[model samples]
Target: MGKKSGKQNKLIPESHFRLTHPSVSPASPIVDTHTHLASTFELYRHKYPAGDYTTVFDFVRGLYVPAGVQDIVDVWCEAPVRPLWREFADSAVTEEGRRDLWGGMGYWFVMGVHPHQASEYTDAVEADILEAMAHPRCVGWGEMGLDYHYDNSPRPVQQEVFARQLRCAVRLGKPLTIHTREAEEDTERILKAEVPKDHKIHIHCFTDSPAFAQRLLDWFPNLYIGITGVITYSTNTDTSTTVRNMFAVPASSPPPRLRIVLETDAPYMVPAPIYADPAFVAPDAKGKKLPICHSGMVPWTAGFVADLLPRGEGEGEGAEGWDAARVMTVARENARAVYGV
Candidate 1:
């Protein structure tokens, strides 16, 4: 993809993509299948790229929980140069306090190297992610896969890393959370080749052509699309239109409700333009919203999705209105099936 022009860039603010859909009811809960809670502000706050554990915890406590998000499947990277499992174990210890604070329950973490950092992959890193999978809280083997936007790592190298991670997930009986940008063809090819035909996979932060999305869905029954704030904050009507054409109405060409999932790649992709506002003090200590994302954003996302649903079919028979609760429940169940949670 080309670098965004300044004018085009202005149209897409940090939080402009937040889902604004209202909830069907206040009592329902939504599961955010993808997040970067462990990293939070500490991970993104500085150029040095080291996180302050205290700040990370506090952010999760203050913002994420209040959002009404019940559960999260967090994803992040560790120093591949170091012993992988040791770093993961240390992360568990450092984060134990914060994890416990989420209503006194532990949170799930997925360990992997981001495509930008894919060049660091070594035998030890692979071994470590594999070892960490057995930990009760370590649910999957990802934020793996391709990122063509930056190509921070070579294309070949990224492919190698993705294939390796897919093999590990297959061997360990774990699901996958993938990252793809501008590399859709290669990403799909790799998924088809590396992951077993029946493997469960999710393309996180999915922003691609409708045709591509449909092809993947039709070809891989176990694959899913992980939607985030982008679906809501997109000012570009064309993008939304494409989404509607592909997944909104199933009567003409229906997309399976069970193939969709929700996520908040928080601290990075804040849903609303809330981050750009001067008065928009975040719920976290970093002067940002809470780090851990919960289901509070569900209504906003679901509302957008409801708009995409074919209104004619669900009309006056109580089908006209989009039920946020029903959509969220489907999202929750879809995520569980994909992740085997």
Candidate 2:
């Protein structure tokens, strides 16, 4: 807990969100499948300008470690790869280093040029990413995909780089972490052509149409949809619809075998439930709630996901329906299966 304010319910930034979900504890920890830890740290520092956190590791240890986040797959998807990633990756090489640096929480990473940076993809950038691949903590080769939404990079360039990175990742036999937005047709075509059906893939922060998600699920057996706090947003009906479709099995049928994983994608997509919590009384002077999202807020997202699951005949006592704990456990296992971290 942080330094409490004068008000009874209000909590300070240092205290962070109170973990209210009964299932989210150290005994049943969760993994953030996709997050940008370095970026999150920077945002945290900015939010708490006078805060005491001195480093990214310190910030994470204070905020996320207590939230029962056992592991994180930090994304390094920029053309000029951040130099600090090497420091973070090296810190997890040994148990002692991890204990000293990451507070015993496992830190893994995936490296690729994001579609927004496709225009800057160069031989030097590829060379740098290739070097990172050999690091012990580099689990996959991605977040590389087409993003037609922003069109930050030219369409042709995005396509070329997407295929190029896919080829490299496939040849290396590394799991792929893809980021596709509004370029579903090209994304489907490229993936089907370039990536093998059996390749392990994580579609990070999936908010696509149900038909698109279904097609990908049908095509790839090892692929899993990454669910973030965005699922809890009222405006993003696609994520909710995608999850609902997965759980829309007949009442007599056994529970659906969900192929999903949870992530924060922070410091973005703060789950809506946090604002509703009584403990969350620390809004800014302008009435803005928590400005940054972190791994600790994942349970709220899980709680939201649990609500989307249908309870059937065999789902209460003999067979439990989807719950927050089960969601965390299932996603943790899926994280291991897909990323091997």
Candidate 3:
């Protein structure tokens, strides 16, 4: 994505798309199950240096708060965990701190070394993660799993680090936030071996096959699939297919409770709906896309998923089908279920 122009063309709501459709109730606050707040803020600064928001708190309040985003699980997955994480985590400990720092949004986090940085994983790194796990705002361990697509680290090292992280998370009784891509076999094998069936697991930003998702769902009763803006992309058939398979069950069978949670995975996966919205279109008609994604944009992703749902079946009914509010409600419940945030 190109850097945003220095010229301020529109207000925040117009520049960044918000769900104005009546079907999406503003009362149903958004709960972002996964995102990268620090990285997203840095990108925001780069893209719009002279823009309205300066501090991360201001950025979040200006963009996310107005859109009714209530809770967020920011991810801290890297080697040599950033010291700023402590500041962010510590700031969310008290209600006053949360109100002052995150604009009254519930801010929680997960920490671990991502598989791309697996080769850098060491005892010190693991110890730092363990220390964070004890913090009141730290919710889980991961975004750690195998990634055969990039294989930035040696495959064996990735596997070893993944298993190691899994063991630590499981031993500590923490929820698992997994990141698996193009390595379904190893991910499944390792998870089945290392994790308990009833452990709360979140398969973040799932882009894998429906069969793999079904297998994981069948194996782990407490597991929930993470749906991001990627679901709105035409190329990502697997994510939509997985959602369809989960919700489009036989009518004879009771409608399966949605085992899915919504996330932005911000600074990435800006939903397609934003591009289509006239409000976000450049005045010059350049079709410039939003340079960054954030928690507030999750409603568009929810609307996309709601479109894929079977009509007149699940929660809240609308003429078109399941209301986006219902999608938000279900996803919010699933987030609380899996992460307890």
- The TM-score values for the models, in the order shown, are 0.74, 0.91, 0.91
Q: How close is candidate 1 to the true structure, as a TM-score?
A: 0.74
Error of 2 at 9 (Å): 17
Candidate 3 lDDT score at position 320: 39
Q: Superposing every Cα of model 2 onto the true structure, what RMSD results? A: 4.3
Top-lDDT structure, candidate number: 3
What lDDT would each prediction earn against the true structure? 0.64, 0.85, 0.86
lDDT tens digits, residues 30-137, model 3?
899999999999988876677778898988777787778889999999998889999998988999988887889889999998999999999999999999999999
Arranged by TM-score with the best first, the candidates are 3, 2, 1
After the best TM-score superposition of candidate 1, give how far the Cα of residue 271 lies from its true spot, in angstroms: 1.9
lDDT of 1 by residue, 1-341 (tens): 35645433333222322323335334556677777654454444432223332454444454455555666777766547234333433444445543664542235778788889888888877777777787777778888888888999999999988888888788888888888888888988988887777778887877777677777877887888887777776554433554565444545543334367877776455555334434344332234343333334555565566567655453222154446666677677877788765
- The weakest ten consecutive residues by lDDT in model 3 span 1-10
Global Cα lDDT for candidate 1 = 0.64
Give the residue spans of candidate 2 off by over 4 A. Answer: 1-12, 17-20, 249-255, 282-287, 312-319
lDDT of 3 at 108: 95
Candidate 2 global lDDT: 0.85
